[model samples]
Structures are given as structure tokens and as C-alpha cells.
Target: MTETVRIATLDGADSFDAYVAWPEGTPRAAIIVIQEIFGVNPGIRAKCDKWAAAGYLAVAPDLFWRIERGIELDPDVEPEMQRAFELFGLNKPDDNVKDIEATIHWIRREAGVPKVGAVGYCLGGKLAYMTATRTDIDASVGYYGVMIDQMLGESHAIAKPLLLHVPTADHFVDAEAQAKMHEGLDGHPRVTIHDYEGLDHGFATESGNRRDEAGAQLADSRTAEFFAANL
Candidate 1:
């Protein structure tokens, strides 16, 4: 089942909306589903549903609410793609982490969930890395995350398990950045990096022009295993 939940920001100034999917039975754990440049749209909601079917409570917050609430964009649409980037530029990463932390606290304090992990995609994939470094998230998984190479200095703060999926041919993330990511995070005990050769970005999106069944299945299975072992 799915529902809308409101989470008060850490500062108690205002609240943001989060789409939540509940499992049929009591949850084994909870996972925060971070969105891409898009907001909490169908693709992200479907991801939550999948996790719910697997017996985890999944919550996806509207990270873009501060700029414009309820945004659902299409990458195939040129104008929307450009707008998505605009929103990305305006969104605050540090502030987003606080909201994520608040979500974690809400799950633990209200729902009594012992372990709370996060899985993010696209821009969210990069936030997953930030979550690992900045928040107390139990575990994190990121797919085709961009600009991660730029944040290598913060890797020292990653205290929990983090799994990153990198698409080698991703136009958004170039070759040099990929190399730097491997070089920076290779030996980190809490980090695992997987490379998908020749695949472009969004290969694992639930449904879209971008989805690649084989790559999605492989990466998702790895994510499930990683969460099971870590969370």
C-alpha cells in the first residue's frame, strides 16, 4: 500500500511531502528512496513499491519542494530536461541532507525501525554519496551518480556501507571522473563500486526510454544483496 506522509523539517519551520509505500506485513527495515533531478515521480514511486513488495517500508521525499513542489519531468523532453538542470542548480545539497536526516529520525522515532538505508538515482545517486558521508543512514546505494569524483575529499566521513553503480559510457559523467572515483574510493572499507561497461545513464530507471532490463536486473540484484548484508 502507498500513502503520502508529511515530515517536518529539522528546523520546524515547515514540512515537506514524502510518498511512502508500505509492505503487506510488518517491515524488516525501511529505505529512503531518493529522487533524480526529477521529483518524487512515478519512476521513483515504482521503486518504492518494489522495495515494499520485498518487505521494506520505502519513503521518497520531495527534495525539490523548496523550489517547486511536485515536479515530475521527462528526460526525453528537451525543455523539461533543461528545467530539471535548472532545479538541480538551485537545490541545496547540504540542506537536503538535513531533510534526509530528519526522515531517518522520523522512521526511527515514530515507526521504530532499527535500520534505515537509502537508494538514490541520477542526481540522487550523488546525494546517496553525500548521505553516506553526512548522515547516519545505515547503508546507501547510488546508480549512475554524477559528480561524485568532485566529493572525494568527504569520503573520509563515510562511516557506513555505500554501494555506487557507475556507467562507464555515461555522457553526464566522463571517463576522467570515473577513473578518479575508482582511484579515490577503491580501498575504502565501507565503499563498493561497480562499473557497467558501455551502458549509458538511467539504464536502471524503473520505466522509461532509458531502462535496460539486463543492466537493471544485475544492478538491482547487487543492491538487494548489499542491503541484506549491510542493513
Candidate 2:
């Protein structure tokens, strides 16, 4: 079952609504499902429900609320993509982390679960890495996170379990950039990197021309196992 709820921000001056899914009986852990450049749309809400079906108390926060509440954009549309990027640029990493932290706090208090984990895609994927290093979450899974090569310096800060799913053909991250990420992050004791060959960015979205059902299933199953063991 699922419902809409508001999580208080750090300053308490603002609150954002999130779609929360609850498993039957008590939850084994809490999973925070971060969104792509799009807001908390049907896809992200479906992800929260999927996690809940896996026995987790899951929530997907509307990270775009501060900029434009309830915005849902189609990935294939050029105008929507441009607008998404514009809104994405308006956010700083620190502010995004604060909202994620607020979501974690809400889960810890409301779910009555001791463990929390995070899974994010696209823009949310980068945020998942930040969540692992900057927050107290038990585990994190990032699916083809953009700009990770730029943030490789923080890989050493991760003390908890982390899984990064990389698609070899992703336009956002090319071969040279992937090499940099491999050099900086692969074989780190706490990090697990999975590379998907012949796949593009947002392969897990199950929509448009980018969707790869096999790849998405493989990555998501790995994520479920990761959260199951770590969270």
C-alpha cells in the first residue's frame, strides 16, 4: 500500500510531498527512491511500490518541488529535456543532499526501521553517491550516474556499501570518462561496479528508445540483493 506524505526540510520553512509505500506488517528496512530530472512521476512512484513489495518501507521525494512542484517531463521531448536540465542546474549538490537527508530522517522516524538505503537514477543517481558519502545511510545504488567522474574524489569517503551500475554506451559518460571512474573507484573495498555493455543512459527506465529490460532487471536484482544484505 502507498500514500502521499510531506517530509519536513532542514529549516522547517518548507516541506515537500513524497510518495511512500508500506509493506504488509513491519518493514525490514527503509529505502529512499530518488527521482531522475523528472519530478515524482508515475515511474518513480512505481519504483517505491516495487521496493515496498520487496518488504521495504520506501519513499520517493519530490526533489523538484522547490523549483516547480509536480513537474513531470517526458524524456524523449527536447523541450522537456532542456527544461529539466535548466531546473537541474538551478540546484546545488548541497541543497539536494539536504532534501535527501530530510527524507532519510523521515524514514528513520516514521518507518520504525533501523536501516536505510538509497537508489537513484540519472540526476538521482549522482545524488545517491552523494547520499552514501555525505549521509548515514547503510547502502546506496546509483544507476549510470552522470558527472561521477568529476566527483570521484569523494569515493574514499564511502564507509558503507555502494553499488554503481554503468552502461558502456551511455552518451552522458563516454569511454574515457568511464576509464577515469574505473581508475578512481573500482576495487575500492566498499564499492561494487557493474558495467553493462551496449546499453545507453537511463536503460532502467523501461520507456522510449533507451529502455533495456534485461539490463534493468539485472541491475535492479543486484540492487535488491545489495539492500537485502546491507540494509
TM-score to true structure, per model: 0.98, 0.96
Give RMSD (Å) of candidate 2 vs. truth. 1.2
Q: List the residue pairs that clash in candidate 1.
A: none
TM-score, cand. 1 vs. native: 0.98
lDDT of candidate 2 vs native?
0.89
> What tens-digit string does per-residue lDDT give for candidate 2 at 6-91?
88998989999889999998999999998999778778888888888888999998888878788888778899889888988896
Query: Would you list the C-alpha lDDT of every candidate in the order shown?
Result: 0.93, 0.89
